[model samples]
Every structure is written in structure tokens, then in C-alpha cells.
Target chain A: MREIQAEEITSVVAEAIKNINFHIRPDVKAELQRALEEEASPLGRQSLQLLLENAQMAAAGVLPLCQDTGTTVIFAEVGQEVRIVGASLEEALQAGVRLATREGRLRHSIAVHPLSRGNSGDNTPAVVHYHPIPGKALKLFVMAKGGGCENASAMAMLPPLASRHGVGDYIVNIIRTNGAAACPPLIIGIGLGGNFETAPLLAKRALLRKIGEFSPDPETAKLEKVLLRRINELGIGPQGWGGSITALSVSIETAPCHIASLPVAVNVECHSHRLTEVKI
Target chain B: MSATWLKLPLEPLVLRDLKVGQWVNLSGSLYTARDAALKQIFDLEADNKQPPVDLKGQLIYFVGPTPPAPGESVGSAGPTTSRRMEHFIPALIEAGVSGIMGKGPLSQSTVKELQRKGIIYLAAAGGAGAFYGSKVRGATITAYEELGPEAIYCMHIENFPAVVAIDLEGGDLFEQGPKTYRKET
Candidate 1:
């Protein structure tokens, strides 16, 4: 068995969280560059330019990409052969996150309590998901999910017999109404099948897929293409000022489910897509 | 299209003349308030108490900026989503607010509330915080400092950019701009 120190995980997470807020993912940056060239609206072109510029400035450490640094969501894939020492996984991760929020000067955005509406101040208690994998090394998938885009996320249980068009329509309608606030062009992650809870999880996890990559499933890959075309037609454009190119990409992840259930989820991520993959 | 430069402490006539889809650069002072501060102001008004600052003739910017890095006046200061704060608009207008600047489209009911009232709405680049932060020349906590980023900040800004989203006669670029570009699919 391979043994990994909890401190090592903490250090890795600390840097990963801080790095993502400042640097645009290379794939996302390339997509934005391509979008700038293809965008039909003059206003969209301008907004895209500002977005690219913001990405550059942020990478240089002039400032963060956004004032709303957002909720920390970590998905950890632990190797079956690995054992952790010194601290609990959650404790290690939270300590690293707290350190980054302070040292990086990222915004402390999480609410202390829903009823109180008070700030959490440290931006701790990240939404973490753990999965067991077959490797000897630990993997962490981290995202600084923005509030605006998160507010745009939706989930529904369509009829088990719902057609391809029916499911697509439900996802498109959510973005049609909420896309403006989410910030565009957006990275659309869709989840299909599984139970009610897992559907949204699949969708949220789908966002970590790089822009331009499609589902491994042949049929799901086709749906991603179709959904991208339909959503862009909404004309939400960049910052909702209007134009062609509402979404940058659409990705889907699906799983087998009970025969009676058909669950769907859409996790909308904004132009400022802050995510990274780290192997330890 | 050439951009129009609008000064703060907006005049009623200027507010009426601003048209949807026009790009504008703003200079001078405005108050920054988002979800929490607006709620506080409304609550204060409900009790017939004065808000910490006089809001008359001022434009309210919906933003919650990051705390400044070393030697910076304010940290990344982009606009927040405006629709969430829609509830405070009418009362703020009644309190003499002339304009607002934020991102996203407000709901129809709120748009109707501002109809013929000469209330101008400006939409900034939503998450371009670093860009907007450069435009802020000065900032001071005007009220509710305990609220951190959501605190009301009186900012002296120069040439901050936005597009006029909704104009005096209930003309909204958000409503019209989409239809203009939406392709029949």
C-alpha cells in the first residue's frame, strides 16, 4: 500500500485552490479566444475581449478574476491502495482551503447560516465529494464555482419516456431564463439518468471536463453538440447584452438508473471557469 | 458607436435622455450597495430612520468587491447580478435614486415599476473584476462596515464603463437585444 501524508494533500490543495482563481484554464482560454473570433455581435466581441483581458490580468496576479471568488468544491478520487496519515481527509482539505482564502486574499463568500445571512469569513467548509478509484495516487478535482453560475443550475425528473427533444427543452428553458445572470458564454454540464441526487452530481462533475471534449458515449456526444447549438440560439450572448455564442461548450455524463426514473440536471458554469485536476 | 460619458449625481433630464444600447463611461461619485446593504436601507426606511448616507440624486452600483490587496484602494470590483436586488429599486427611486449600474436583466415587474420614471440602468462586464477595479480611484465604507464586501461604499470612480440596459421609457436592451440576434432554429 502507498502511504500519503495528510499534510501533503493539504499543501497540494492550498496551491491548487489559489492557482485556479488567478489563472484561466488553458482549454477554457483557447475556447474564449476562438469564441472571440466567431462571435457575430460587436458587443459580444467587446465583452469577450474584456473577458480575455481579465484572464490575462488575473494570471499576472494584478487581481483576482472576479470579486466573487465563490464556493470551493473538491472532488477527491482516492486510490484503493493508499492510506492517509496525520489528519482526517476533510480536516486536511479544510485547513489548506482556509490558508489559501487568507493568503490568496480571495473573497470569503459562503454564508454562515441561511437564516442569518452572515458571512462564513474564512470560506471554509467546501462542498467535497469522495470516490474510490483503482490507482496508487490520490486525485483531486477542484472548482471555484461562482455564485451567479451556480444560481443558474437546475435539476428535474422528466417522464421516464421523455424523448430526446423533451429533455433538451427542459435544460434549454432553464438557461433561457437564467443565463444572463450566470454570465456567458457559459460551460454547460448536463447529467442524465441515475437517481434524483446522483443526476445533479453527474452534471456538476461533468463541468470538470475540458472545453471541446465530448462524452465517451457516442449518443451522449451527439446530444452535447445539439444542446450547444440550441442554447447559443437563445441569444443570451456575453453578459446578456445579446448576440450569437451564448455557450462555449456543452458536456454530458450519464449513468444507469432504475427503469422507472429519468432524471436530468444542468450545471451552468460562467466564462470564468475556475477548475483544475491535481494528482498526488 | 461612440460612447457617452455620464457624470454622477445624475440629473433627471440626463437620465431621461439616456437610451438603451448606448455605451457610457461614468465619472465622479456613486454609492455601492448589494443584497445586504439594500435590505438594511429598506429596513431603515421602514422604520422611518435615515440610512447612513443621503441617497438622493445618486446612482447605486450593485457590487461586493474583494478587500484590497496591499497598497490598492479596493480589490477586484466587478458588478454583481442585479435582478436579486430588484425589490429595493422602487423604494430607492422614491428615496431619490436616479440610476443603477449592474449586470443582468431585471424582471418585468421591476422594469414596469421604473417606467416613465427616468431611471437609467447600466450593465457592466459581469465578472471582469480586475478591469473594473482599475477604474476605482477612491473608496470608503459609508455604512455597515461589519458587512465586509456587502457594505455600502462611497466610491469616487473615473470612466467606469457600462452599456445602458434600460432607459426612461421602459426600453430595455436586455429585452430587445436578444430578439434582434436570436436566430430561428
Candidate 2:
């Protein structure tokens, strides 16, 4: 088995966490550029212009893409044949995130408890999900999720009898009522067909996909297009001030589920889609 | 069209003249607070107590900014969602707040109170943190310093770009702006 030092894992996460905050993803930036060209409303166009300028400033490293540097989420895919050294995997991740939050000057946004209102101070204890893959390679996908959009995320288990249009309607309703507050032109990720917990995970994972890339499943790909149109048609627009481009893209992921359950989860990502990945 | 540069101590006349959908540049003293800080003040008020800062005629920006980098006025300071703080608007208005600054449309109750109190609601560009963070002239933690990013901060801001999202007349940009461009698919 190949052994990787825990310090290496921490430093990698440290660098990635800091950098992703400073720069918006290129795919997301390109979508914003396209939105600027296609946007119809005068105000929508102006908002897009400000976002583009913000991107330039952020690229200069003067400031990060957002202030609410948000909850740090990491998806670590570890090779089954590899062993981690120096510290436990979870401890390494926590230490890495803490180091980056302090040195990188990212905001410490994690709270200790819902009722106690204690700040973690160093932005530690990041939510981590581990997947085992074959071989001696380890990969990490990191996201700095902002509160406004994450607060808008939801999950529901629809009746298996619910039609595809019904599923579409439920998703649209979620955006119509909750989308504006989350920020827009949103990158919406929908997870369909998994069990309760799995569905939401699938949805969150869907958000990490490249913006505007359709799913391999033809039906899922078509559903993505349909939802994108239906959502943009809501006229929710950028920042919910209103316009033709309410959503930049709708990405979906699916998994097999129980025969009686048709679970769905939606994760709304704001225009400042901070995502990055690394392999080692 | 000429630009509107509003300085501190915004008079009632200026507030009245402002309408939904008009963009304005603000330069003056502002306070930054979000969920926790607002909740503290709300609880304080419920007990017939006073908050640390005098909110009278001041605008409260709903935000939790990163600590400043060296030689910079602030770190990426941008607006957070306003809806979460909607319930605190009345207490803030009662304390004589003249304006609210944040992103997204507020609920009807919040809008109604703003209209009644003639408090201006403004939207700084959401996700445009780098630009808005530069506009902050100075920032000092005023309350809840232990809360870190969620602390109440008094910020001296200049040339901060904001649109009049709601005004004294009950007109709302969030409602009107989107309707003008709605397309049936």
C-alpha cells in the first residue's frame, strides 16, 4: 500500500481552500460572460457587468470572491490501497482548513451550535465525505459554500407515482419562493431517485459538475434543459431583481432507489460558484 | 444622467425623492450586522434595553466580512441575504434606523414597515465583494467582537454602489424589475 503523509493532505487542502475563495471557477466565469451577452434587461446586464468586474478584482488577489467565505466542504476520494500517515484523515482535514482560514484571511463562519451561537473561530470541522476508489491515488473536491444559497437548499421525497412534470413543478416552486434570497443566476443541482440522505448528497455532488455540461443519461440531460428553461422563465433574474437568465445551468445526478420512494434534493449555488479540485 | 452621491445624515427630502430602481452612490457612516448581531439587539429591545450603537438615522448593512488584508480598508465585504433579518426590521426602525442595505427582496412585512417608516432599502451588488470591499473606508468592531465575522462593525464607507430596492412609496424593484423582463416559455 502507498502511504501518504497527513501533512501533505493538510497543505494541499490549505492551498486549495485559500485559492478557491480568491478565484471564481472558470466554468462559472464563462457562464457569467455568456449570461452578460444573452441578458435582456438593462438592470440584468448592469448587474452582470459588476460581477465581471468583481471577478477581475478577485483575480488580482486584492479580495476574495465573497465575504461570507462560508462552510468548507470537502469530498475526499481515497484509494483503497493507500494508507494515511501522521494523523487521522479527519484531523488532517480540520487542521488544514484551520491553517488556511487564519493564514489566508478567510472568514471563520462556522458556528458551534444552532442555539449556543459559538463560533468555531478557525473554521474547522469541515463537512467531509469519503469515497473509496481503487489504486494508489487520492483526489479531493473542495467547495466553499456561502450561507445565503445553502440556506435555500432543500430535500423532499415525492410519491413514486408523481409524474415527471410534477417533479419539475416542485423544483420550480422551490426556486420561485426560495431562489431569490439565495442569489441568482443560480447554478441549480438536482438529485433524483436516491434514498433520503443519499439524494441530497447526489444533489450537492451535482453542483460540482462543470457548468452547462449535460448528464450522460439522455433523459437526465433532457430534464436538465427543461428545468433550466422553466426556471429562467420565472423571471427571477440576477440577484432576483429579475431578468431572462435566472439560472446559469441546471445539473442533475441520479441513483437507484426504493420502489416506493422518489426522493429529490435541490442545492442552489449563487453566482460566486467557488469550486476547485486536486489529485495526489 | 448625472450620478447621485449621497453623504451621511441623509435628509428626509433625499429619502423621499429616492424611488425604486434608481442607483445611488453612498458615502458615510454605516453599521454592519447580520443574523446573530441582529438577534442580540432584538432580544435586548424585547427586554426594554438598548443596543450598544445608536442606530438613529443610520443604515445597517447585512453582512459578515472577512478580516482585512494588510494595507486594505476591508476584506471582501459584500451583502448577505436580507430576508433572514426581516423580523428585526421593526425593532431597528423603532430605534430610528433610516435605511437598510443588503441583497435580495425582503418580505411584505419588512417592505411595509420600511414604507411606513420611510426607511430606504438598498441592494449592493450581490457577489461583487471585491468592489464593495474596496469602498469601505474604515471598519472597527463595535459589538460582539467575540463573534468574529458576525460581530457588529461600524464602517465608514465611500462611493458604495447601491440601487434603491424599495422607497417610501412602497415601490419595489424586486417586484417590478423582474416583471418587466418576464418571458413565457
Candidate 3:
């Protein structure tokens, strides 16, 4: 059995939060550069150029990539053979989030209540998902999900007979209606064939994948390509001012479901597309 | 097209000259407010009480910036989604606010109100916070300090980049831009 200190988790989470906020993942940066070269609209090209410059400035530590440092979402995959020492996993992760927000100067965006609208000053009680795996190592996936894009996420439980084209239509409609509100040139994550709740979770998880990474399954990969083409064809472009590249990439994660249902969820991510992973 | 350089508290005539897709680099004084600050202003006005800041002829930015790092004027200050403020914007327009800077499209009703009021709506690059923050030369909290980042800040900005998403004549880029560029598939 592998023994891991809880403080190690806290330190790792803290550093990961700080790093992800400061740096745009290289793959996302590359895609933005490509989009900048290909964007036809003058406004779209300008927006992409500014986005690229923002990434550069953020990497230099001038300021964070976004003002919305985002609600910290952590996915922890813990092996059954590993035991956590000292504080519990949840406590450790929350401590790490509080540290990052305070030391890194991230925005404290969490509200204490929905209606009262109270601010959680330190941005605590992170939304964490835990999974038990067979190996001795622990893996952490962290994402700073902006409120604008999170508000745009959707899930539907369709009849089992719903066609794949119908699923594609729903996604297109959501993007069309969202327009510039969700920060276009978005990274789209799709979850298919899961149960009612898991579908959305799968979609959110799919976002943690590196941009441009496709599913190993041939059918799913083809669907990703088709959706990407159709979405860009909508001309939502960068910041939705209009161009040919509405989405940088489309990724899908699928699961087996009961015979009676075809559940799907779409989680839209803004151009910032901030996510990072670490294994310990 | 090259961007037009305009100073804030923009005159109606200057605003009228802006087209839907034109780029702009705005400078001079601007006030920042998002959902919380807007609500407070509305509540105070409803009670017939003095609000914290004067709105007449002022430009409001719908943003909640991150806290500045040491030696910086402000943190990454970027535009938030503007739809959430749609409920409260008409009141601000009635109060003589000249224009709004934000991201995303305004509702049709909001667009009509802006046109009637001769107000302008500008779109800042939404996620380009670091780049925008660098343009802000100074920031001071003007009201609602208790709201933290959501507080109203009077900011001095130089050459802040934006697009005229909605002009004084009710031209809207969000609606028209897509229609012009969309490929018939």
C-alpha cells in the first residue's frame, strides 16, 4: 500500500490552481494561433489577436487570464491501495483552494446562498468529485469554470430512439442561442448515453481532456468532427462577433445506459479553457 | 478597419457616428458595476434616497475585476455577461448614464431602450482580462466596499479596446455579424 500525506494534496492543489490561472494550456494557445491565422472577419481576427495577447500577458504574470478566477472544480481519482494521512481529502482540497485564492489574488466569486447572495470570502467548499481506482497512485484534475460558460451548460434525457443527428441539432441550437454570451470560440464537451445525472457529470469531465484530443472510438471521433464543422459554420466566431471558427474543438465522453433512455449533456467552456492535471 | 480613438462621457453625436462592427479604443474616466452594485443603486433609487455615485453622463462597465497583485492598479478586469444586468439597465439609462461596456448581446427590449435614450453599448473582449487590465491606469473603489470585487470602481483607462456592439441608432453587431458571416450549409 502507498501512503500519501494529506498536506501533499493541499500543496499540489494550491500550486495547480495558481498555475492553471496564470498559463493558458499550450494546445489551447496553438489552436488560438491557428484560428487567428484563418479567421476571415476583421473583428474576429482582432478578437483572436487580443485573446492571444491576453494569454501571453497572463503567462508573463502581469495579471490572471480572467477576472472570474472561477469556481474551483476538482476531480480526484484515488487508488484503493493508497491511504491519506492527517486531514480528510475534502478538507485538504478546500484548504488548498483557500490558500490559492488568498496568496494568488484570485477573485473570491463563491456566493454563500442563492437568494441572499452572500459572498464566500475565501472561495471555499470546492465542488470535488472522488473516484476509487485500482492503482496505488492518486490523480487530480482541476478546472476553473467561469460562471458565464457554466450558466450555458445543458442536459437532456431523450427518448431511446432519438437519432444522433437530433443530438447534434440540440447542441447547435444551444450554441446559436448562447451567441456571444458564453464567450465563443468555445471548447465543447459532450456526454452521451449515461443515466440522468451522470450525463452532465460526464460532459463536465470531458472538458478536462486536452483540447483537440478525440475519443478513441471511431464513431465518437467522427461525431466530434461533424459537430466542430457545423458549429464553426454557424459563424459565431471569437467573442461571437462572427467568423468561421465558433468552436476550437469538440470532445465527447460516453457511457452505457439503460435500454429506455438516451441521455446527453453539453458543457460549454469559454476560450480561456483553463484546466490542468497532476498525478502523485 | 482601423479603430477610432474616443474619450469617455461620449457625446451623442460621437456615439451616433459609431457603426455596429467598428472597433474602438476608449480612454478617460469610467465607472465599474455588476449585478450587486446595480441592485443597490436600484434599491436606493426606489427608496427615494441618494445613491452612492452619480450616474449622469457616466459610462458604466459591467465587470467584477480580480484583486490586483502587489504594485498593480487592478487585476484582470474583463467584461462579464451582460444579460444578467438587462433587468436593471433601463433604470440606469433613465438616470442619464451615457453608455455601457460589456460582453455579449443585449436583449431586444434593452436595445430599444438604448436607442430611445441615445445610449451606446460596447463589447470588450470577454476573456481577454489580462490585456484589458493592463490598459487600466488607475482604479479606486467609489461605493459598496462590502461587496468586494463587485463594488463600484471609478477607473482611469487608456486605450481600452472594444467594439461598438450596439450604436446609438440601435445597430446591433450580435445579430447582424452572424447573419453576414454565416455560411449556408
My TM-score estimates for the predictions, one after another, are: 0.98, 0.98, 0.98
Candidate 1: tens digits of C-alpha lDDT, residues B55-166: 9989999999987888877888999999989988866886878888899999988787777566788999998998898889999998999999999999989988889898
Q: Candidate 2: give the clashing pairs.
A: none
For model 1, residues A78-100, the per-residue Cα lDDT tens digits are 99999989998889899888888
lDDT of 3 at B154: 95
Distance (Å) between predicted and true CA of A108, model 1? 1.0
Which runs of model 3 end up more than 4 angstroms from their true locations?
A: none
Model 2 TM-score relative to the real fold? 0.98
What docking class should model 2 receive? medium
The second chain of candidate 2 has a TM-score of 0.96
Q: Predicted candidate 1: what Cα RMSD to the true structure?
A: 1.2
Which one wins by DockQ: 1 or 3? 3
* Model 3 Cα lDDT, one tens digit per residue, A1-280: 8988999999999999999898999999999999989988989998999998899899986589999999999999999999889999899899999999988899989999989989999998789999999989999999899999998889888888888899899888888888579988999999998898899999998898888889999999999999999898898788989888889999999999999999999999998988999999
Task: Say which candidate scores most in DockQ.
Answer: 3
User: Which of candidates 2 and 3 reaches a greater DockQ?
Assistant: 3
Per-residue lDDT of B99-131 in model 3, one digit per residue for the tens? 998999888888988988889899999998999
Model 3 residue A149 lDDT?
93
TM-score of chain B of each: 0.96, 0.96, 0.96
Winning candidate number (lDDT): 3
Indicate whether candidate 2 or candidate 3 has the larger lDDT.
Answer: 3
